[model samples]
Target: MLSTSGTIIGIDSSTGACSIAVCRGGTMLAHFHEDMTRGQSERLAPMAEAGLAAAGLGFPDLDAIAVTRGPGSFTGLRIGMAFAKGLGQALGIPVFGVTGFDAVARAVFATEAAAGHGIAVILESRRADLFLQIYTTGGAPDGPPVALPPEDIAARLCQEGAAPLLLAGDAADKVLAVLDQASAAMLRSSLITAPDAREVALIGLEMAGDGDIPPALQPLYLRAPDVTAPRAG
Candidate 1:
């Protein structure tokens, strides 16, 4: 089991970004990010090694590993999870899973301007739907994550009666057109486009402290997979 002050590493390759971070006692020691629409598998390992190197650590030094468990690119998620699990297995450390919403909410709460505001993390699917979740002002998630269309997302938040809502994720802008004047006024969007591995590390630290780590790492596929395997001979 990871101690409260244990060192943790977070990895996220679940979107356009491939990120890695090392954290100790809730503080991020080092992190690396590469922005690419694809090819995360090629970069994730070196990035992870670099982050560990930057932190003056090695795989065996980690007490736990955390990773964004999906609701983003299918290939990206698989690549990240595999790397994280491999590290955990090799180093004999625990591996935990985090959601995109958890990362976004942690990042939002990390901002001073977002203090005391509810949050809605909206990750866009390649299809017409979105992956959504809510967190209260203090960064505690309110409920389970769900999927909805852009219009329904706007309407649902309105029904939830969350005022001064802090919005993050790439598809946040799409929900704006469908929001009523009152709903729009009730919400405030942030600059975060997608979840970051640093935030994943931060939240992972908390989860480690609180002993809230997941039993297993699994992809949070809000929708069906976007890719189909090519026919083999």
Candidate 2:
């Protein structure tokens, strides 16, 4: 368990956006987010500096670091994890890893809109398939997240049930398109949403307080990257 009342900085560059937040005692002191498909490596540190400045705090004041350990953009995930680990190492502070699923699901669980609805989180893979996880109305994961074609995902959700469902994440619409008309008709969506660092901080604090921090924060890549091998020498 954490010794202090928790002053932490959360960083997320797991999707198209780069975001950072500073929270002390479970309240956000400052946050910054910008949507960009690239340039997180160049911009993340300056943005962290800005968040610290806006919060009227400095690096020495932080008790821990929290970051999204992703099933997200491969490049984006590395940018965030590297920044958080480097800073934590330099400052001698523990770093906590929160999943991309929990980061976005936290927002949905807090809203009244989520009542009476199962949640299906669909993350973009920048490929033909997508990353998906389902949650009960009360916010427990139905199973592990997986990368699957839209049709397969639709089939799985149908097996789960056809109750009113809420679809979330950047790729919600693509899943909506592939669902059977019955499932499609009972759905609501929050397509503009992406994982935000503000929630990352809160979730991290909860994880730490419960002594759930991992020994190592590894990237939660749902599938391998789409890299091409170089030509033979």
Candidate 3:
């Protein structure tokens, strides 16, 4: 739970998806999310306002703001960070950045038991690559995230020597085909997709309470943005 009595807001415009949530003392009071491919800049502010309204609060009542740092769409991360910064500054509150994977992991770990193979979160990164991370069932890291080709990820999973693996996040479907063939006998994977805004709020609350907020709250771009300048002539 947050150490203070004020409200906290969490934003995640880190993929094609967008979400905003408000919480009081680690309990989510309201949230909004959309799986749209565009229009985040226009949608985010209203969503934030709606969340605050649902919580019977306003921007001035907030104590902190949280946002997904990334390993996601470049444009989406920028938009979310900019919004969080603006709102935090205007409200005189702190802004914290949480990774998309960490948010999802927190969400999953809250409801599930910690006795399975592990949790694998895969979010689409626009190209053929994916943003992938492995976490123990207890929300501890098995390894850091890596951007890997679908086949390579499947191959590695086949070699992991684990069973009953749980898979979640936006890109689970795309990875399923590859994983099915690669690890058919050795591993089992489930596709469960949903972003729990409440879970995000809870995690943000804990971070705020702990005073572990980042200095800048930038996006966690795991790989370089897809677009790069052309070579000098």
lDDT of each: 0.85, 0.87, 0.75
Per-residue lDDT for 24-121 in model 2, tens only? 88689999999999999999999999999999999988889999999898899999999999999999888999888888888888888888888888
Evaluate residue 220 in candidate 3 and report its C-alpha lDDT on the 0 to 100 scale.
Answer: 76
Better of 1 and 2 by TM-score: 2
Query: Stretches of candidate 2 above 4 Å error?
Result: 160-163
Candidate 1: where are CA atoms >4 Å away? 211-214, 227-233
Q: Report the C-alpha displacement of residue 39, candidate 3, in angstroms.
A: 0.7
The digit string of per-residue lDDT tens for model 3 on 1-233 reads: 34755588888887777898888884678988898878999999999888899889988888888888777878888998899899888877788878888887776665544355577888888788888888875677778889888787776666645545677777766677765654655544444454445555666777778755547876677788666788998
When 2 and 3 are scored with TM-score, the better candidate is 2
Question: After superposing candidate 3, which stretches have Cα over 4 Å from the reference?
Answer: 1-5, 113-115, 180-182, 194-196, 228-233
Per model, state how many residue pairs clash: 0, 0, 1
Q: Which model scores highest in TM-score?
A: 2
Each candidate's root-mean-square deviation in Å?
2.2, 1.6, 2.6
- Number of the predicted model whose lDDT against the real structure is largest: 2
Rank by TM-score, highest first: 2, 1, 3
Ranking by lDDT: 2, 1, 3
